[model samples]
Target: MDWEPHARRLADTVLRRRESRWWNVLASTPRHVFVPAWWEHGTSGPVARNGPDDPAAWLKTAYQDTTLITRMGTRHADHTTPGTLLPSGPWPTSSSTLPTLLVTMYRHAMLGPDSHTLVTTGTGYGTALACRRLRDPSLVTSIDIDPYLVTAATERLDAIGLHPRTAACDITTNLPGEFDRIVSTVSVRPLPASWLHGLRPGGRLVTTIAGTGLLLVADKADDGTANGYITADQASFMRTRHGDDYDTASPPPSVWDAADGDGDTVTTSRYPLLDVQNTWDIRSMLELQAPGIEHRFHRSTDGPRTAWMAHPDGSWARAAAPDRRTSPLVHQGGPRRLWDTLETIRDRLNRTGQLPVHGAQATITPDGQTTLRRGRWSATL
Candidate 1:
């Protein structure tokens, strides 16, 4: 089947809002080659689709401006049989990031004709775009913690006649070489020290903060520290992983059950129930204020809705309301008041109309300590 037209159409869609030099790169690259098969999460479970078996659907879906999940819980779609449906509960482990987001990240890097770039090899599509943008495969190096991903991405890139250095290493611990630009598709907490060490002086690193939607663009300084501001554009990526799968650090069932039950202190909330997961800014601010809080929201067919927040520190909050417009009855337990913190943030937002996380000034020390400051508000991670 002819896939060029689909790819060109995709490029047009992705670059329609703005003019970019990546237009030709996106138009010419065959995204279907990089994503031959993928998993789609549905109401039932994750269903696998094999590209070769359905060429038309493959071309259509592959060219769309959407992320295609390639790996979930170590089960790569490439290795899974077509029409296979897996039981729910395993989250996506790897994917070909949406084209527009990829362009946004690459544009932030400000890659030049000869810039040495280091990129995460998720499906090799982003690395392919970088190679095409640089016009020299040797100037691009791709790495992944999953050895199978590294090997498969390397072979796929080679099949497309683009060869760049590929390695399997935990990016949190070490980097293979120094480069002018480091663009990661995965989020990291407290910026990794090895990234700082691997970055050449004056080099730029573009990545997102884990557990938040803050896109960080920092340039290395002579003193080994990096200073930059969080971009107004928000993005979220899978956190960096050292092993085959991400660590299961979610709050236990008992903790969630406790959050659902009556709280140590129950009171009526000042505002209506808001699902933190739906709003990026509010969720990002709450994560900054109360780090490691797992949020869950449930809405029944009727008008009632409930939101739950649980932290690893034995703190949990539950808020339930009769409808969207009504105030919620909040229950708080343990040491900290998670819902109160969220309400305080919401209150600030309602009063000031903004949160400090966006465009916040960020400074990362040589040891990977990140400090975000905006006016009088400051936070460290």
Candidate 2:
């Protein structure tokens, strides 16, 4: 079947939302080509899907403006290519971040026709959007830590009749050159000093600051410091992958045995354990501040629901309810109280009418450590 109509429909969704002038990039960019083989999690290894073979399903998902994790567990989908189902571990390696989120990021970067840009490439989706917006292959440089992803994105962009300089390099260690703007699709722990140094004076950089609840949109100062505001928005892309994604596992027996079952009281939650992927506010905030925390919610046939949030940092929370409309009795334990953090932020939002993000001051150290200070509360990640 022809795919253009489906692409148009997806573009229509984006346009209706007034998200991006570059929405056609989503329609024109052949997502399936870049993501021919991808992994999805199940009980065992990730289930693999073939774009050419599963054209209908592929077209449908590709057009929906949703993020698709193209790699999972330990496997890099680009390297493994199309074959059969691959083993999935416990972490996502790469993804096509949802179209709207991609648009928001680019829009936030404030790229203009004169801008020289550097972007991180995972699935090449965001790079495609950048090329579409700037329309100058020479102005955009896309880099990836994984040589395999860089290679694949290079070929796919070529196939689509778009070309930007693509490189296999570590962005955290060194940026290829000074840029008028830098936008990263990956979550990073801080605004790399290299990025600040590599930015032309007065150039702006937009990226999700890793391991925290923040996004930084900053301009380089004369002294090489980039200062900007923390956006009220939150986003979390997979952290730039290294050789592998998953870390050594903690003993499951100890995890369960140590789980607090005491005042970890069980009660009803005011909201359903939100499938954050479907919720805009919380998901964006979570992405900006605390990406990679996984959520598990159990709902019974009788409407009883229990939700658990777990993070790699040894944090976990259990919140449950007998029905859909009550506040949950929450139980939390770990090095840090994960739920407490969430609730604390939520409370700040409730009382102050907003969380401290927009207009928050961002100071990027030469070492790449970023500290976002909002009034009396300051956070670093």
Candidate 3:
């Protein structure tokens, strides 16, 4: 089936403005070719879809301005059979990221006519877009830690008569070479030092903060320091990995079991129970204030709700409410008051209009020491 019309429609919606530099590049690329199969999270688990068996569904899904989960855990959808359902607990490790977000990262980099670019090779779709936009395949270098992903993406890219350098290496370590621009679909914490070292003088790098929806864009300087600001636009990507799968890091099960018990301190909350996982700004601010807090929420059919916050440091908080309109009964334990910190952040947001992390100024040293500042507020990660 012909897919050009769908691709064109996608470009119109994703780019929105016809004058966008990436409009033509996105319109001409065959996304379906790269995402021939993908995993869909169903209520039961993960459901697989094979493009060859369902052409109409494939075109419809591929052309939409939505992400297609190509890999869940270590299993790539391409290797899974249709109608297969896998138990779902593992998070998505890779995807053909939504077109709009990819364009946003590219635009932030401000790719020049002759810019040599280093980009993530997930599904190779983003690299194809870069190749088309640059009009020279040789100017692009794509990398992924997974050897299988690199091999598959290389073949798919070659199938479209586009060939660029593809490497299987952890981006957090030493990079393959210097480039004018670096755009990563994968997120990282503290900004990788190797990325800054591999960047040519005056080079720009665009990536997201690991645990927050923070899009960071910075340019290297002659002094080996980079300075920039977080973009107002929000985006999140899977954190970078050095192995086949991310290392499992969670609070001990005993901490979760004790969260509901009587705490060292218990009181009524000033605000109604909130699922921090669903509130981006609050979640982002909380992450900035105290990193590595895992949130969980449960709502009963009758109306009662419970929210939990757990940290690997043995800190835990639980709040329960009869309904959304009522304040929750709170409990806390461990080295710090996790819930109180969240409330303080929420209070700041309520009292003031916004959080300092949004659009904050970012400065990075030669060794990847990152400092974000806004007025009197500052944080180093």
Candidate 2 lDDT, 220-251, residue by residue in tens: 88887777887767666666645655455333
Q: Which should have the higher TM-score, number 2 or number 3?
A: 3
What does candidate 1's lDDT look like per residue over 1-381, in tens digits?
799999889989999842668889998899999999999876789999999999999999999999999999889999999888987777789999999999999999999898999999999999999999999999999999999889999999999899999999988987998989999999999799999999999999999999999999999999999999899888999988879998978777778888878899999998878889989989998888788899889998669999999987789999999888889999999889998899899899999999899989999999999999999999998
TM-scores of all models? 0.97, 0.81, 0.97
Cand. 1 TM to true fold:
0.97
* Alpha carbon lDDT of each predicted model: 0.92, 0.72, 0.92
List candidate 1 segments past 4 Å from native: 17-19
- Cα error, residue 270 of model 1, in Å, equals 0.9
Estimate, for each residue in 1-381, the C-alpha lDDT of model 3 and write its tens digit: 799999999999997888987889998999999999999778899899999898999999999899999998888999988878887577899999999999999999999989999999999999999999999999999999999889999999999999999999999999999999999999998789998899988999999988888899999999999999999999999999889998878788888988978899998999989999888778888888898899999998759999999999999999999989889999999999999999999899889889888879999999998899999989888
- Pitting candidate 2 against candidate 3, the one with the higher lDDT is 3
The TM-score between candidate 3 and the true structure equals 0.97
lDDT score, residue 85, model 1?
Answer: 94
